[model samples]
Target: MTITKKQITFSQAINDAIQTAMAIDKSVICYGLGVTDPNGIFGSTIGLEEKFGSQRVFDIPASENAVTGVAIGAALDGVRPVVVHQRSDFSLLTLDQMINNAAKWRYMFNGIHSVPITNRLIVGRGWGQGPTHSQNLQALFSHIPGLKVIMPSTTYDVKGLLLSSVFDDDPVIFLEHRWLYNQVGLVPEGDYRIPIGKAKIINKGEDITVVGMSYMTIEALNLIAVLSENKISCELIDLRSIKPIDSKCIIDSVKKTGNLLVLDTACKFGSVASEIITLVVEECFSYLKQSPRRITLPDFPVPTSPALTSNFYPQDLKIMEVISEMLSKKINHQKQERPPISMHDIPGDWFKGPF
Candidate 1:
């Protein structure tokens, strides 16, 4: 049980994961725009070129579609490629290759070949990134078959999950919250892989079950502290992997607690939150003490104005309010003492960014 644990930032953990993968496997290559630069896409790709040389770690042109096609070709040829995109918004250009080619090649060929491609997509809100710069389209990406989609909220997860995604046999859309970049947590040194389709319970309670994805997981953890004071004990489930969500973990928790609240980054009609809630109602409905619920961004474009953006994303107070309604308890409407929110539509002050 005794193992070393050292605190590291989320970005550094990703860097460590890529480095570890490259060190063990010569087939692993890291390439993307500005991947070899000094900032290194928030430092995840810094020093990669120096260690692995230009051929394996150099930058690519602004041609997203062509770059993705090339990576797919390489992966089919047995090279593991990790492609980094500075923003998820622009990765839309590569969706045709991702959805049609990378995601469907193995099945089309009757399982003779697989694309072990890892696309590192930086997602979430920060620094007024606005509609064009910030978006978490996990639901859209996860909808396609033969693709693995994961959103890691912690540094430990950032490292282990990146390693897992790199070694995975199918295309993996690794959606990372840029806001979680500076969050520090203990990570086991060296190579380790968290199983791709599992969920982790960050806080255990019996009154209600709250499943939070990506940054919402962090917000759920924060909200739990306040909910506890009002005698509301909640079970917090962080769905690290989105596509093959750990229904077992969520169902088990909801069965015990009999209450469910799903929180996610986007507001798709049939979103991650909707699917999880539907799963609980279908399977764990008999155990329900309260109706299942969810909180998500409005089904609209993200606002660029910081003033308008403050209310665009979900918040802890929103969770608290939702919980209050579920419990049939009144929330305090009076102006109360609370710290100011520095980052709107984002949780945790973990981002130290130039983006």
Candidate 2:
């Protein structure tokens, strides 16, 4: 049961996934903006072109729609094309190919064709990237029927889930938060594939259930210390895949805890948070002690200034605030020990250089 492991950053895990997949399958290819650049899409695609050669790992232009179309076409021809987007905010331009073409091909064509493509869209923030660049738009793609939507929170999950997405027959939407690029964790040395639709229960408890999606999972982990101090036993679930979210796991956790809190990077309406709440309401309504609460950004444009952004993005403190309010405990605004992480534009100080 033992396995070898090595510590790696989230970005390096992503790079490792691509490298392994390309090495195993001749039909696998990686392309998109900055795939060949020095920064390498925040270093996830670092040195891919040099290692795999430009024919397999290369860059494309700003033609979102065109790039998607070509990738879809290539996928139809029995190639697995990994398309990278610098920012999920700008991926809106490629909806036609994503939603209509790639997402519906198998059903529309009577299962004659399969588009086994992986779309790696990097969600941006910090440095006042503003409304157009800082948005998390996984909800848009998760709504599509044929695509597999994933937002991995750890280095282990990133590599495994990316491997799963690469080998699967349908198109996959792989979301990576900019802040998570520097986060490090243990990753297996060999190939490992986590199931696409499964959710991981991070902590088991009885007081309440907290669901953290994408980067918010990291924040939730940080709030563990504060929650434990208050004797709030939290059952934390990481919703790794958004489309076919592990609803059964979420419902079971809610049933045990009798309270639910969802922390997501997107707005509440029609979001991953809303969808989880809907599942709980439909199947475990009677198990609730309190109404499910969702903590997410306002359904509006992200602020552009550093000062505005400090208050704009909710972090560990905000999660603690929401938890205390939900449990009817006195707000620990001043009493709580502040999180060790500095309040900054990005998560880490390692972001000084490119990527």
Candidate 1 structure quality by residue, lDDT tens digits, 1-355: 6777899999999999999999999999999888988899998988988998888898989999889999999998999999999999888999999998998999999999999999999985856677888888898998898988999989999999999999999999999998788888999988889999999999999988999989888877777666767778889999999988899999999889988989998885879898888889899789999788899989887777678877778777888899888878765534333356566544434443436
Q: Which segments of model 2 are wrong by more than 4 Å? A: 331-343, 352-355
For all candidates in order, the CA lDDT equals 0.87, 0.87
Instruction: Note the residue pairs that clash in candidate 1.
Output: none
Poorest stretch of ten by lDDT in candidate 1: 345-354
TM-score of each: 0.94, 0.95
- lDDT score for candidate 2 against the true structure: 0.87
TM-score between candidate 2 and the true structure: 0.95
- Report the C-alpha lDDT of model 2 over 105-222, residue by residue, as the tens digit: 9999999999999999888877777888878988888888998899999889999999999999999999998888888899997789999999999988888899998899988987
Off by over 4 Å in 1: 330-354
| Backbone clashes in model 2 | 0
Model 2 clash pairs are: none
